[model samples]
Target chain A: MSTKDMSERPTTVLQSLNAAMHRLMAGDSRVVVLGEDILDPYGGAFKVTRGLSTQFPDRVLTTPISEGAIVGLANGLALRGMRPIAEIMFGDFVTLAADQLINHAAKFRWMYNEQVRVPLVVRTPMGGRRGYGPTHSQSLEKHILGVPGLWVAAPHALGDPGSLLEQSVALEDPVVFVESKVCYGRFLTRPAELRAEEIRTARSPFPTLHLTHRGGSPDGVIFCYGGMAPVALEAVERLRDVDGIRVDLVVVAQLSPTPTDHLEALLQRGISEVIAYAEEASSSAGWGAELVATIEEIRASIAPRRSIRHLRIGGAHTPIASSKEMELHDLPSAELVAERLLECF
Target chain B: MKTGERIPLCNRDSSPNELYGLMFGIRTFEQSLLDLFQRGVLAGTTHTCLGQEATAVGVFSALNLELDCAFSNHRGHGHFLAYCGEAELLYLEVMGKPGGVCGGRGGSQHLQHRNLYSNGIQGGIVPVATGIALAEKLKGSGAVSVVFLGDGTLGEGAVYESFNIAALWQLPTLFVIENNGFAQSTPCALEVAGSIRARPEAFGIPTTEIRTTNVETIRNETSRCVDAMRDGAGPRALVLHNYRLGPHSKGDDNRDPAEIRAAWDQEPLKVLRERLDTTEVQLMEAAQTERIGRARERALAAPRYEY
Candidate 1:
């Protein structure tokens, strides 16, 4: 491995998203942005859309507090040959626009027999760490995970947000591009081999990254993305240093259309146990449940008859509390992740 | 379907026979669906536009079919037929045949044929239509987008939000409110508070109200309004005051039968039939029934979806 460039740090997720929007708007005249409180100065609640209105005043629209209308408007724009990226201020507010997204935007292409292409991108921030309470701090992407024809792309801590978003904007299908609230300011670091060149050139519907522990054969693997990406890495390092156990980390950039190829390939590496971590609540049927089912189905066809143990670590199944302690208790911390891995082993 | 200039109903190529033929097609098709439901042929219930044919035919007749688009509400059979005019396709869709518009996935409420889209959700299509208009304005296509909204949809906040944006952006959108007396089982008087036209008017959109069920007059006004929109007049609204001649759904008839009978007198078909020859109308009705019978046969013969 090459020496780390400590002086040179990677761009943050928010910066990457901002840069991606700017690039997309600059490249295509049909690219338009709409969101509540997305005007200049305020930019947005999270400021991911900062400087966009200033650069593209005619294209950037400041919408009212109508999530349903905002998404539907984007769909109309897409149908009219314009690519629109709608920003739902918070992930939880996506429930208001569920009717449009689930029914109209997702089903427009197939429902119309592929005569129309709805290239609408719905960008929203998910996950909570700053004690934003129950409404604001939720990983609600799982609720929409199973929606057919909808692509959900979540950026890891070190994932290329600009490239993922650029690909999302160019997609013919509707995409639910999720940005982690906690990971917006977090710096992205990757192995020396996984450079920016390869990240920008990724064209798959689902892009995955594999980081091994010091080039050693992995004892296990942890599958995660977005806010949990950093936590999984931390857990990996703790296991290697404290317990002398080496594990691999897999970051899945795409959450929907289920990334079956990349996942099956990972399982084909013949790992004995796989651990999945998510920021979503521990619902009965979530991304983890789907992932486990897919892994089990693929595992049945393996020649060696490998008995791969699948474990999951997710957020507590309760409303996020306001207090710092309760907030920490609600989210799956790195300590808890490492402890869970150790217990499973 | 021709663009550029507005065409008046008198100068248009459509004769009364064709117009009545279209109306008769929708009425008979919906009647057949009701009969099918009663005879245990159909599985689910459907909302029918039995009495609101003129509103769909009139407004749709004014649109440039090749350029302008439309979004309809639950009672959208008339709207879909008015735009596409394919009775066989509508039958296949309603009968869950693979030859349906949405390949049998979407039934009566969820109809999509070319530029036409309809869903069962109230007020959901408003924002989508506004966006379509926004796209039209941005492309400088001079094409307008029309949303067929029910009085019940007015209760939804998203509808007003779409109105505000459509007016604010000067989008060429037309909000056609089919203000049939009752929203499902609830009466408009009990559900809606103020005047229907006043709602869009507050958003600075030009509002038009048609009290009579005259198809020619409705088409004339719609053409004039559509021409104004094409001339960059921004968003406008029209409230077609009408009544439901049948129950809300197959097994939900909370409305008084006497009120329905009274409404049947003012129904668009009856109102428009008064202007046409009685003998010709009877022959047109017979032809419409035969056409619907052929369509039903084709739909039934078409491959049904297994899943």
Candidate 2:
């Protein structure tokens, strides 16, 4: 809303995130980065933590390959007056630290009569691109968002990186930072002239703006976030070819408390059917459940012209395997994403 | 029941063995509970840490209160007392009263404090302590975590898992195995198959098996190993081979007194008493009077926990 000072605009999510992370590190001494191979020995498996160790050697620590240990240690550090930014090698490995993350970090303050505080951030990659299926590819943010004491920050665009990320790190509670593996290498436009769209090989998860159809208005809306945003955009493109229907994209940057205000206002503008979050993992507790819950609360207030649908694709209540074939079998592709988007009609 | 003979830690001190004095701390602590139980004052059943105090006190005494965090077992009053002393919140818990720790929702087994934490599950505190130590090591806090488990817990793989992780991370943790020889009447020989201290040593951890009953000797060994760990040397274990002074819990009311008398024959506390021939007569009387007074005060205060 305050774009009067938009002297330089970002065109990619990772670029915006990079600028935001750089700003945060320079601003706070309590903020630090950690995880396996996050240091110069190897600038992290995804480069999300690249160069942080060199810039803040005392703060950026490279831990052993133990997701549970990473989360547990972060919980401890957070309680001990440090805002630790921990990383799991992959989203799949986060299951290993469920005991600490779900049970301790999430419940510490509430369990201890509000005596403990877990001011920490977890940065990990989910979703597949390079054939790292079930085991390596998962957008399991829902698994953690349900836990208490944690606020989920999943920016879908490069814009507002400073506001979204800096506020997340500065919030008094724990924050979950989810990065999609499929989007890590992507680039973006910072300014029309001074854009630095570098090939992101390091393990750094940056931010970029997603201008699917710059400055376009639509009669209908689709609310979504995380790795599925791009897929949803592709599906929207395909859907437009068939009916030329005006489709609005509401790319959410946060997931914990659904943004009902934005969606409601869009729906009020005569949108017939609005599709919400969907992905692999399980239709039970993830976005599917959240969609139904949010819609149920506001359905009575919506006009007769508005409707909501879930573009879900999930599996049984077990961890997905890392096989490419199985992963593809698990998550619905861009074609299916298009099909589901049309189903709202 | 003190015969009033005190032995000094040194030849020149001319006082009671400081080690036995600390055991008396736990012994007196338990005796107070027993008296309260008989007087129908302390409510609910308790798993006394009578015979196991030396191991806990020895190690806990070496801990730096400001930096160290401890995970306690179901039987952890000594731990609570050693760390923060007279945890009134815990008393509220046992009394099944509103003001108790856990708001009385968790009785004796669920004792927990931030500086000192615990859970009701057996060998449960092992992993919890491992996690705490992992936190300390990760934060570079120079703080150490210690968990005291019975030999019975050796059979639980959770302890082994915790040991593997603690040792793997070189976490500053002290694993104290109070081998009082039994797990609720099931002897350790009947349960644990391999060596106990070997569990840590196999992981290249520096373990000390000080099979001593003397509180002072236990303290010396615990302090040495805890010192090494606190200095970030790595996780260490101490196997205090001693005798269980009382039945497992008040539920063991049917326990044969003969069984206790039989175990008392090799009593580590008794062994300690015999080593104090040079104890001064005045200090001996004073130690006895102190023990009795402490026990009486606890008994008269009425069990802070009321059913």
Over the stretch A1-345, how does candidate 1's per-residue lDDT look in tens digits? Answer: 242432266577777788889999999999999999999989999998999999999999998888999999999999889999999999989999998899889987876666689999999998888889989988888889879889899876556777889989999999999888888886556655322211122334657877765554677778788888888877777887799777777788888867777767766665556465544566457777788888788888774566767777888888888788988887898888788788876
TM-score of 2: 0.74
All DockQ scores: 0.64, 0.18
lDDT by residue for model 2 over B1-307, one digit each (tens)? 1111121122112133555555555566566667667878667788887777666666666677667887777778767655654434544556565555555555676655657766555654576577667667766788888888888878765576667767776888888888887888787788888898887788787888877766666667877887788777889988878777777876474456787788676665676677675455336547745644643443245344444
Choose the strongest candidate by lDDT. Answer: 1
Estimated TM-score for each candidate? 0.92, 0.74
Given candidate 2, what's the lDDT at residue B197? 82
> Which tens-of-lDDT digit does each residue in A210-275 have in candidate 2?
233334445344555667666665655666666665565555666664545544544454433555
Instruction: State each model's C-alpha RMSD to the native.
Output: 3.8, 7.8
Candidate 2: segments with Cα more than 4 A from true spot? A1-27, A150-153, A158-168, A188-221, A252-274, A300-330, B1-50, B95-98, B101-114, B120-143, B149-172, B180-193, B229-235, B242-261, B264-307
Share of the reference A-B contacts seen in candidate 1: 0.71
Instruction: Provide the lDDT at B175 for model 2.
Output: 89
The parts of candidate 1 lying over 4 Å away from their true place are A1-9, A191-204, A214-216, A274-280, A303-305, B1-17
